[model samples]
Target: MAAIPKTHRRVVLVRRPPGEPAETDFRVEEVPVPEPRHGEVLVKVLYLSLDPYQRGRMRDAASYAPAVGLNEVMTGGTVGEVVASHNPRFKAGDIVEDRLGWQEYAIGGGPNLRIVDATVAPISTANGVLGMPGMTAYFGLLDVGQPKPGETIIVSAASGAVGQVVGQIGKIMGCRVVGIAGGAKKCGFVTGELGFDACLDYKAETDLDAALRTACPHGIDVYFDNVGGEISDAVLRNINTFGRVALCGSISQYNAATPPMGPRLMGTFVGKRVTARGFIVTDFAERYAPARRQMGEWIRSGRLKYREDVVEGIDKAPRAFIGMLRGENFGKMLVKLA
Candidate 1:
């Protein structure tokens, strides 16, 4: 159980930026610690998830997820330990799920939380590999990408949280996995540690077309798109007939002030008869147990590995979150609460 405080620190979105969010746009403010009334519990946040999708919500525009209002706390998933509870289902010391935003404390009511064995994995895993991003890679690849054994799969942002898991899972399933990440370091990690068959450094690729052609010599059967600008367009040009594409996060367009330019590879989709679909993790929340179970089994068997670039202190979450947008983070970006 955590020592309940009278006040707690929270990161507020003080201003909605015209384009990308600056550090000053977010304000670190202290608020009164809320008391849990009946059927409620107070959660002391242990870790906060920082993802590229959060960038879309920072803008005041219509999006899949609602925008964060000015002066409101930035929205995000959190793993927290319950300190006080008036609910029968939850009690002190129980670690639970929460969308508590960038805050140190939260009063949760109703049934949004999913109780977990905090010891099963590190508490932070629930916010990354064992959490939403993990499930996203699983469902997106298995259900959408339909990576068959012996098929050639190409995944972008290969060194990031979702991409690494997808590549590892693809490898385990007998598929040949190729990855695209920024810089030489990330490319090395993706090919060496993550066990991808081949990796291309997007930053170093002088000719994206040549790289795509060389990497996907067998013709790409599945494209796990993470950045949906020129990189995705280049991948689309080489897709095999009846290939599939999983439209995951589009970090390339996330920070753009205006609509991003594209290679306009829509014609290739028609010629290749490719199937591309966009999905949100919430769509498969019902199947979370199965995914989590599979992940646990993989982890125990050592077939799957997860890497997180954790930043210490809740006060630093804003900086970490911004860094993720700029592709400065490697693997899962998370902040340990102060």
Candidate 2:
């Protein structure tokens, strides 16, 4: 085993931003690494997942999860290698995945920590496709959306971590998939590479409602929402009767100082009998094993694909996260910490 360092760096939330978070909101500091206690293991972080939901954590507000306290480590999921262990479930050289925050090294033994099988895929994937984002895409679309064969599914932020998987899975389920992305590049990737029936560049399209109407002429049956706000309004406006919407994140409004007014299309839901349900990936925790196995098979057989946009270090997390919120990232945002 390699010698453990006495100190390592980690990013912590130093200020709560009322609007978009700036780099000044975080402070990267080098602190002494602590030894693992009984039933705990020390891990060396390799990759840290930068997600949209973390923006909500930066705010000191009530939500489904607790906010990141000021001057505390910013919350995030990490894939790491166990360097030392006092836990029977893990040992040296074992790769593991956990919500260990942004740090070079951390103690792991929490209920959420689990060993990552390196052979099935790369360790970083444990933080991306095979991790929270993939699971979120699987359950949120399958269980919540309940897409049926021949249905038309439109996914907003279609080139993102969860959205990309959602659209591909829709295709697998025999649905006509249409993606709404930010730029021509992302739109091209969604259709040319990911095999979506069509993709609309929200930035290029002058009339999104009309574009959606044309792409999904049969009308959208399932809408997997990732970036909410105006885009969602357009999709909702074109939804078919009995349509299903799986509400995920709202990246467009995450950095807002004040919550925007509710969408004007909710009344349409009453007339159309649409079903919209919000979900957190952990809602399907007990079924992850089988879900992951199925996803793994899809990946191995070249049915499902994933892309990641990686920044080199922990110090870059804040800036990269901000860019991701602004729709600058091409795919899954990750910090390569090791």
Best by lDDT: 2
What local distance difference test score does each model get?
A: 0.88, 0.93
TM-score for each prediction?
0.97, 0.99
Candidate 1, which segments miss by more than 4 Å at Cα? none
For every model in order, what is the number of clashing pairs? 0, 0
Tens digits of per-residue lDDT for model 2, 107-223 = 999888999888787888898889999999999999999999999999999999999999999999999999999888999999999999999999999999899999999999999
Please write out the lDDT profile of model 1 over residues 116-139, one tens digit for every residue: 776567778888888988998999
Best by TM-score: 2
Off by more than 4 A, model 2: none
- Alpha carbon lDDT at 295, candidate 1: 93
Model 2 scores a TM of 0.99
TM-score of decoy 1: 0.97
- What lDDT is reached at residue 200 by model 2? 97
